[model samples]
Target: MATPTVEKFLLEVSRVLRERNGPQLQDILVIEPPLPPLYNLMVNELRNAFPSGQDDALEDKCTRALPEYVEMEDGSSWTAFIKFMRQYFCFLRDVNVENLVETFQLLRNLVKQSVNALGHGSMGVVLLPTVIAFSRALTKLTIALHKKPQLIAHLIRRQAADESGSRSTLVDTAADVLRDAFSGCLNDRSVTGAGVGSDGRPMGKKISIYVIANLCLKLYFECDKIRSAEQIFVNIQNGSPPLSLYPASQRVTYLYYLGRYYFVNNHFYRAQLALQSAYDGCHSKCVQQRSRILPFLITACMTLGRFPSQALLRRPEAAGLAEKFLPICRAISRGDLATFRSFFGPEGPHTDYFLRRRLLLPLRDRCEVLVWRSMARKTFLLAGSQGDPGARKAPTFDLHDLLRLTQVLERRSFGQTQKKPIGKTHTNSIFMFQNSQQNGIKPELYVDPDVKGVAEPAGPPEPTMLDIESMVSSLIYQGFLGGFISHRQLRFAIRGAKEKGSLNAGFPNVWEVIKSRSSDAVPGWKRDEVSSVRNGVSRPPGPGMVIHLSGARPAGTPPM
Candidate 1:
């Protein structure tokens, strides 16, 4: 049977709605079935409208189509379809299983139409509703996925699922198709074209890219398709119009999702930078949105092996969440695995929330590493406390103790219920965790030291000496642990360093505002008000990372 077109289907819908108000109308009958076909038809129209490889023809086609859109369709059916679309597309209406697939297809089609129907920049303002629609869809869909894994199967069949349960790549679908459409059109914007704006950008192009990127990220994050999201972001970052052209809100949102993508992949430093950008630009009105970014921001720091220097979480507004994280911060800093587990375990306030987003494990790595590194640190400290004035802190950690430590960390930190040691000692004595795809610790167990816990080298009449050196190497490489491993002595040297001479960039204004009329009851050297003001002003302060984006200051910046 041939599928009916939405325009033809809308004739009946208009009649039904005309009789009874839309409130009583079944969404399935009026809004769902015809949508997929409409989307396909619109895409076909866009493919024909926005031709590729012909710069001259592309411009001519866009100009010609502008007039057609203004006067092309029947007033009754198409208008109603688009009006209902405006509501559904902008997330003003509800969508159910019957219509969800069609809704995504509709969103993709709307973008395709918007991208191709370019004219004056201001005229393109209507395109933003499509982005808003997409944002809501992605948020809802991602949440739904936790409840319904196959939610988007009707619209985009995920071929990523396999016997080995890991999502590596998504099957080619609407997201990729939209990407191709956008890429093909972007190919035609002349580098030196007259469309360049007062801000030295191509008119009508930057805003479209801004809107499109936000949607692309939702596909990656919400749709559970990592490679597609990465592809879209890389494309934008490398060559597309500058994202900064978008408003602060859009920029913040894009960077936030981008940061999350980076976070999951163990790219903590880059994730920190992107998330920091989001947090910095976040305004007071969007506290809920800002709150969403906060836990991830803190996660980025923990992964990097430290708590942020700034009192970000201690702010009056942020204290609620920060108070909970404070225990975690102290636990990880001191390498207290027992306490760390209690703070982030099942009953912890933030654990379940962060776990829902797949963020807690990333946070746990640093804690694991901290526990192991702290052991090594104590070994060095104990040795250094010997009678010799020049005694270096050295690893005297016993072989069985190391094994016991590793076993406990594996079970506790990883939720690894497997009651066995992960590896045997090599002849060179390097302790390597067996890369078990079965256990899914191939990366987190060995390559990533921040993932936590230590694998110890067990010695025997067996040719292998304990391989403590290799395990320590991995930890130091990722910045989770400090000092080098001594292969000759078969010990991990513990050299603890501190961030001495660090200046607090976030508190300069607070110091300036301090109107201390003598010290309030504290015994102190009472300095003149003028002297205090001069000291505060003469500190040679520098600009810090944007507000709320607390991290170690970039190196080579003069101390504030």
Candidate 2:
């Protein structure tokens, strides 16, 4: 049954292996010219075989003769293993799973035979090189198939959608195949443990993990497997050398995928830190990747009331975000709600992206802060101007007027966002929520034993200086409006001179704000009890609608 051409090749290889040392072993195999090639091919025939493509058939035919060559009196297992692997990679697409299984089995037999002949020293020296080559082949195979899992998903959804069989079946099959292969290989951490391979090198878990991470980087954008991928990263995070010890590109990609997972889950601080690390580690030549990460990075910073540094903003990769958000940034700093609305309106160009990313709610909160600060400034000016000319105490800005001011600012702010269909509903919902605050006698921060229970007003209690002051207190605590509320009057002023620079910088300079307040009221700093909820989060009472404060939380609880 043997082909005459293959019979000649096997006879030559067996003869050379019998007489050869390392140089002759290297040369006859034609591994490289400076090394020996003891038995690969006649020079003319080797020249005719070509480098790749159909030449894989020629290589496969030659490799099938490997065991025949090894069975010859003096032929060795090392030559058969190397020859089989070279042919396998060369004809990778055509190789079946059974053939692959046979190959690893051959590897085990070959390595153990080498260990017996060369003694224990050969276990490390001989098997180490073989292990390295085996790893590279698996890595190469993994890289080749890396996109298949996602490709299968897309094909099912797009090309097979609506078919009677159901596209999900194909998708599930593809996911199952990849999941089993990747998980099994990566989970086996003890590569060199005695019983692992039984006869040879166990599959190296390190290379498998790196390879799977590469696939996950691609899969992350392709499907909903992020949670699984995140867990994989976590489980392997403490591996011997650590994932950080992987190639730089793999580490950067892992951080990016990890950061995106955290971002979607609303862990802003961790997301910010992870994204920043990814951005820092990004290669200089990878401009598009750097550009892709900028928007999420910008939004994460904004949610925490901060901005990326000017140096970071100046990069060409960040130009688009800087152009779109700079106006809102400046508006926030100036406490100019009108301009913030102009740039940040729901119908503005980037609105859908922000909403999809769940950043719109936080942006809306910042807008309220700007509007509330303006309202506070107006209240301060009115207090200075009105009431008795020689009055010892400043006249209170009427609760009615402040309520009306909030309505006007809210209307204008929402009006800008009203172009989109959902924008109208969002505006109406916020308006109704704020109006409810004015229709009741809300609890004040007062701890008076005499005022044991809230008095039920005959009708909704008209907004008072106490109610107004409570709204201000809530805003201060939430880090929305930077300045402190007056304990005596409901007046809101810009924070002390030193912190004026960072007032609307997004992050509240809390220590400065608290330091400016008198020490007397610090112990039981009054907190407004928010009675309203929208979409599950509590909102402060009155027009400016700050975020909720828990039951009687101390004012000092705000972080510096």
Candidate 3:
């Protein structure tokens, strides 16, 4: 009783649906009238062709009718239709009552057709919706059939290889696709009727998460975009506490990527926390996964300045983590190259050479302490030009020499060893002092150092008491004092100073100066001012002046 045009359209749609050629179905169904009967007939044919065993046929009829009013001429309309077919295919794929896997090849053809339509720009208006739909359907199919991850991974890689436009534009398109797919999975709530689960939870949630995680990682690798991955992870972390997932292995995988995301962003503190949690969640027997994550965990700990356990440090598994990284301390110490190379495996020689060339060599030259030593060596060479061979001491500014000095100093001051290289700026200042001593520069030790004499021909003098006070005042003027120093830091520095006399002797004073200036309450600075004045004038402060200032202050005012 149907018109020939109607029958011909029905036959083509039937062929596409039977073939599971969703893309072809999309093309044939693009121009259909918004008629309930037409939709109902199509639904009847599909259901009869692929039956769900306890079906109220009317439910299919109503579900199919919902797509009738959706237009396909505009992007929004096309998006909607794509969404519909996506869900439709997902429902077909997941319905346990049906044998959809046998028909998946046919469905793949339609998926291919839809992709081709998108490429041709005929489906531009609905490209996003179509993408979302296809992803949802693909996710459902994978979950229902227990498909391997490589299949989806291959599809994503192929799409990324298109090479069609500016790099930024291509990345943006890929990002949009991932974003839409993520949105679809989060919004989908039709699990019960689709036979996915009885509790209205889609069987696809885990698979969806897996696919999105891999896709996000691919996006990060290919395009270097991370926001999508970050959002997906944040959502997962906030939506459910990971421990609730029975197969903790899958959840740990998510945590791995989450930690990696933070690590790549240079958020080592957070990366350490997340990676540690992942390691804790894994079974004790899963040594391979633990081996895979150990290096990242160690790197995070190193970056955060946390000392890793000796067990982790000595484990053969730790070699992978230590191998590529050239820790500043280790490189400076010139630890065993063979040990270092063992981490890089067969590429050890090449990697070791590059590491020495690019990092160790440049670092040695630019680092301040070494710079001071080099200058001292030059000065000693020049001084000997007048023929005083007996006056020369062996050059004593090697890495071991510095390490021994730092260890001794740290032990005397802090009662504990520092576990990492000190900042280059601070280390350089100490090196200069050592070089001055070695070169017989006779650095004047005075109670009140003169400020002007501190200036070198090379550059301005290091900061004096007055200069530090003024700098603090400037920072306070800009309202940056509160941000730079906290009350606790001030207390710690003060406590540290009382235990070690003349805290002003080293870089610790720099921290103190910044702290005192930023504090709401001022600090006593008689010693600092006296040291500065004495150094600048190359003379000692008389006892009478100290007594006069001590007597001049009011009851509670700090001496300055």
Candidate 4:
């Protein structure tokens, strides 16, 4: 009952499998939505012959219609491929109708059979290319389903009861599919040695781990289920070989997500390490990706008190970022509390941008301490009397001086965000009633004692001495300041001014303090390991190879 074209296609698939041709099998099993002409023709033939209203009958129909189907041969080993192919055809038919419920079900089966093909001996390894192709198709469909929330709800309702009775999205289901594939690749025992594949090229199905993982990570993040991605990192770190063995693009992307994960968990130092590696390894031509990374990188550096340079801000990838970050950086450097609040506060121009990126709250909280440290530094410079160089007592500034500065900055900050009355200009409103009352006379303005007696509405509580004291004490405790506060005298004195210079002793460098407290190694980042074998040969660099150039002149150095 098979059409001539369908029969020829099935026979060609069987021939490719028999020959163990991975690339050919991949082409024959193309499964991205809107199937290829060959696949479309096959599905159309099957639909005409055996139509199922809403059931899984492709197998039954194939069994009856094509009894000579190649997989039906006794002792045949192409079972998984045939199953995956049928499911893929069904998926393409249903996808056009937007039958998400049915399409997801088919996707689940396709993932299962693909993973099975990976586990089935050397033949499975030959199918690795096909598995990768299927994974690409899977990632697209999964992400597409995730973007439509209404379909997720509909799929949930029409599907069977859940064991956990909790809600789930199609992307989460796809993650399980991808995770199974990832585990299959991770546990691939066919690797001849560490980081080397079976066919002797530093390659194998294990090379597919990050490919699947990066896809799964994409889904988790898109679904706002980032915490669920922790196991992916844990598994790779505990068992997978050095990440440098992988391609650079994969390393950059994985590190990017890893950095973002650290950022969300409040590990700013670790976040900087991961993001810095990602940004450096990323190709210069990848402008959009580098741009995606810069905001987080820039923010992380700012948290550690290292501001972006003019050259960095001028990079093509950093376009529009200067408008967003430069003002805050200037405020932090200049101790301009009013400017900081105007830009980061609720009425700030970039508030929407910051909030959209989830940066508003963290920036407001963390960088305020840096601002206070700057303010304290400025206060010492302006008001403190530098005692004699040989004086035993350290240089000190009165708390009252800091208090006055704090009050002025706080009031100025409050004034910048004040809202004016909605409708009238001052002159138009103050004289409008006069013109209406006396046709053409300009009414003399008089102050009303009753109105004056009513106190003006209070602004933000002026920064009190207690607030300033507590803030200075915090800066000292956090190691941003190398000083201590005196309770009785209400003054802050540098601890080592007699031995170390006043400026050096009073304010410790922010980056150095942070770096000292953190470990040097970053989890899941591999920088040194290199693969020893490729394609069954040991190919070390030749002696004359221009590998390391320690003697090379640095950029911008004048040549002698």
Per-prediction tally of clashes: 8, 9, 23, 0
User: What is candidate 4's lDDT per residue for 220-255, written digit by digit as tens?
Assistant: 887788999899988887667667778899889999
Overall lDDT per candidate, in order of appearance? 0.50, 0.50, 0.42, 0.77
Instruction: Supply the TM-score for candidate 2.
Output: 0.49
Candidate 3, superposed: residue stretches over 4 Å from native: 1-171, 191-207, 237-243, 282-291, 314-316, 320-560
Q: Model 3, range 17-46, lDDT digits (tens) per residue?
A: 345454554454432124356555555554
* Model 3, CA-based lDDT: 0.42
RMSD of 1: 16.2
* Residue pairs whose backbone atoms clash in candidate 1: 365-450, 365-451, 369-452, 429-465, 429-466, 429-467, 430-467, 431-467
In the range 22-110, model 1's lDDT, one tens digit per residue, is 22333423332335555555434434443333334433332332333334444312222333333332321233345555455455454
Superposed model 1: Cα runs more than 4 Å off: 1-196, 200-202, 308-310, 316-320, 341-351, 386-470, 473-560
lDDT of 1 at 446: 48
Q: Which regions of candidate 4 deviate over 4 angstroms?
A: 53-78, 97-102, 151-164, 197-202, 420-457, 526-560
C-alpha lDDT of residue 319 in model 3: 54
- TM per candidate: 0.52, 0.49, 0.36, 0.80
